[model samples]
Target: MQQQTNYSNELSGKIALVTGGTKGAGKAIAERLKAAGATVVITARNKPDQADPDLYFVPADLSKRGAADSVAKATLERYGRLDILINNLGGSETPAGGFAALNDEHWESTISTNLLAPVRLDRAFLPQMLENGNGVIIHIASIQGRLPLYDATLPYAAAKAGLINYSKGLAKEVTSKGLRVLTVSPGWIKTENVKYFLERIARSSNSSIEEAQQSVIAALGGIPYGRPAEPEEVAELVGFLASPRAKYLSGSEFVIDGGTIPTI
Candidate 1:
């Protein structure tokens, strides 16, 4: 336990910001970074029902205009320095009937949330990081970015794909300046949103929850490891990437999909 505690404190003295950190993977990532001894700040549209005492919660819908600037201003006023930034805000609200079902608003929202929010946040906070001469920025993308699901998350996938490309290019531009940038692409994490989605599918089909989950998995090819990732699993990767352990790593996309992608 002592060794574990020491290991988790890897980010000591760092100030980190996690967007959409109210729940699900964002919450997990925030907690993980906090456990790693970073002063973690979380931003979402609303505060969580039960907030973590260790984290500073900032309320802002990052998809909206000027939200990124607002968060950066608040964070800078409070912490004075930003050592890490995690772009974990992303989702798809478009209905699952494929391209014809999607419209301009859906595409625009997805792109704004998944791609442009990070771009704006990076623009806002990166100056502080660059000034400090050290920092890490992680974009929590989706495996759908690479292996897209046309019927459901097409826009989300495309946005994430754009994010991945942008992250790589940004890393190339900034790594020489001592700021590290990377992307994490996770496949089907069993977050609260996914669980609720599975429940809804079960209710609609009059089937068991397990059946609904398996059906969704089958749609994504298959999880050779036989389960969706837990939020903490993804958080672990983010924590490492944010810490000095991964100091040598930058500009890469780490895919955590339980071997579901089926390619090198």
Candidate 2:
């Protein structure tokens, strides 16, 4: 069982912008930030009917160029300043297949959503943050960057790998100036999408759900934890990274995978 820890409401005076905060890991991150007392604004392509009225929402398709600028403008307009930018939006929309199975469009879309989206948003927002002389940017990347599955996720893996590099470079560039840029790479997380994917695999292959799950795990080499992580677990890491408690921890990439990565 996981013990609940008080997050100190340390983010009391901060304002945060979390991309893709409607569901999954992004939603968890947004809620955690709110619990820590930050005024949060969220961006999404689709708005939910029961969206929290306390939180500001900006609608923009991040894969589209200039969307980030629009979101930044709206966030600043609503709050006048941004203290935290959480790049929590990404996925592999590519169809299943090896190298020859994917085309130019698939690659471009994957790269745009996974890598370019955050880069563009950061470009529009980070200048203001840097000028303010203090801020934190957290990029939510994936473990596929280091351990590529290669089948249908090559593009996503490659893009996340680029993001890791980009985050590192940006961190080094601005750390001395009092800005903190960090990356968090999560392993297989138990999201609704994954559950649906597994169900489809089970139905199509006429295999038990357990078997399909094991297959997914096998593809990852093996998960020592024996299962995927909860969205909240990933969110807790985001919370810590965004807190003042982690002040000296800029530019680091924290991998939260229950020892699954098999790396030092």
Candidate 3:
């Protein structure tokens, strides 16, 4: 028989910070990093329903001005250094109804949350990471960046597209200076919130949850894999990318959309 490889300590001495880590894919990513032996720090607007003792939690709303600086200060004061940064706190609260329904406030708020927050956080932490001569920055973007749903998530898609472009530019500037920057764009993730969303769709359409899910998938031009991705699956990709195994990877957007994008 072959011997089993013990890969649990890949990030034994690394310290990672994940934004919006109280729930959904953010929580999953934080957990994954922790399981891989990194000291994980998570920040969100609210406390997690069930706390994990191993992970450090900081309450913050990144959309507010100066919030990024506060979070960076708190983390650095505690850990002294950051090895990995995951910019994952993003969402749109704007009402549906296409461009005409939106106003300056809607666009500004959406842009601030989805684009500016990450930029501010990155600025706050970059000095230390650059001084250390090593670090990894991963931006959690969305597939909507490229394939946007105009009726509901236009601003969000635009912001994520900006993030993707910014991530690439940052990578070009930092990759030679000992920092790695990458983007992960995922499509419909089947999280707890998404389950509720599906339920609502089911009720509204007078259909089963499965049918509602299929309808949503169909609206996305179909996920070739036949389902939305699980939070853990996306977490797994982030874990690998943040590990030594992907040392050669940088300045690229990794799409975990299950082929929802029709064109290459």
- Model 1 steric clash pairs: none
- Report, for every candidate in turn, its global Cα lDDT versus the true structure: 0.90, 0.89, 0.92
Better of 1 and 2 by lDDT: 1
lDDT of 3 by residue, 30-79 (tens): 99999999999999999999989999999999999999999999999999
The alpha-carbon deviation from the true structure for residue 17 of candidate 3, after best TM-score superposition, in angstroms, is 0.3
lDDT string for model 2 (1-264, tens) is 999876668999999999998888888888899999999988889984577976788888999998998999898887888999999999886765579878999999999999999999999988898899999999999999898877667999999999999999999999998899999999999876787767655765678988978877988879898789999999999998899999999898999887888777
Cα lDDT for residue 89, candidate 2: 91
Runs of candidate 1 exceeding 4 Å displacement: 1-5, 199-211
Model 1 Cα lDDT, one tens digit per residue, 127-192: 888988889999999999889988667999999999999999999999999999999999999877
Worst lDDT window (10 residues) for model 2?
196-205
Q: Which candidate number maximizes lDDT?
A: 3
Those runs of model 3 whose alpha carbons end farther than 4 Å from true positions after fitting are 1-4, 195-212
